[model samples]
Target: MNIVLIGYRGTGKSTVGKVLASRLGRTLVSTDAEIVRRAGQTIPEIVAKLGWDYFRDLESTVCQELAMRDGLIIDTGGGAILRSQNVDSLKKTGTLFWLTASIQSIASRIGGDTQRPSLTGTKSFLEEIQEVLTERTPKYQAAADHVVSTDGQSITQIVDTIQSCL
Candidate 1:
């Protein structure tokens, strides 16, 4: 079975995923990183050059591909769960773990990241996060088989919680 990590950008999915995969002796598959590697661009670059639909299409394809693999720890992009198809595909052979954090925590963790473009084009980062997260919270909740809070938690603590859940 695969262990899939889902949440917003700053929730430690990638970091915790790396440690989880190492502890479980599984391969780590970061959908965003893979997309970047394959497309020869960062996420912001992809969104800027091709648009959000194009990026989502690419994300869907990646989700479909990764869903077929076993013994992997998949770290999904923050917006992966926005599409029901992506969520369904990832959950087919994977245990979905939604890593959650307060808006303040996320703001603090990824306040000035340039790699990811803003989903809401006209808003400030904090404003965008508040709005986007308000809409995405229910989707994330529905997608997750387990929900773990990452706020004020260390990488080791988060990994331990996920492992215990598994």
Candidate 2:
């Protein structure tokens, strides 16, 4: 089965996914990167030109494609689970781990990152994080086979926790 990591951005999904892939000798496929590749643009560019709906459609396609494979480490975009179809596709042959962190942790981790466009155009960065996390928590909770909190944990510790779960 595939090991899927889903979480808000800055929650360590990408970092943990790389280590998991290396440790397990599995291919690491990032849905966000795949979307960028398929669209021939960065995420912000895609969102700017088309909109979030278009980007999400691309994400769904990627999810469907990835789900057809096996033994992969999938690092999904933060919003991937917002659509039930994407969640369903991912869970077809994958065990999802929801990585979580406190808002403060997330803010610190991603404070300078510019690749991701603002999820809420009007809100401050912290406010956006809070609002988005509040909205997505339930979806993440429902879709997750396991929940891993990243606050105060090293990458090794987080990976060990997930490994133990598996």
Measured by TM-score, the strongest candidate is 2
Prediction 1 TM-score vs. true: 0.97
For every candidate, C-alpha RMSD to the true structure in Å: 0.8, 0.5
Q: Which lDDT value does model 1 have at 83?
A: 96
Regions more than 4 Å wrong, model 1 = none
lDDT of 2 at 72: 96
Q: Give the TM-scores of the predictions, in the order they appear.
A: 0.97, 0.99
Clashing pairs in 2: none
Candidate 2 structure, TM-score to reference: 0.99
User: What local lDDT does model 1 show for residue 4?
Assistant: 97
> lDDT of all the models against the reference?
0.93, 0.96
* Global CA lDDT computed for model 2: 0.96
Candidate 1 lDDT tens digits, 32-96: 99999989999888998999999999999999999999989999999999999999999999999
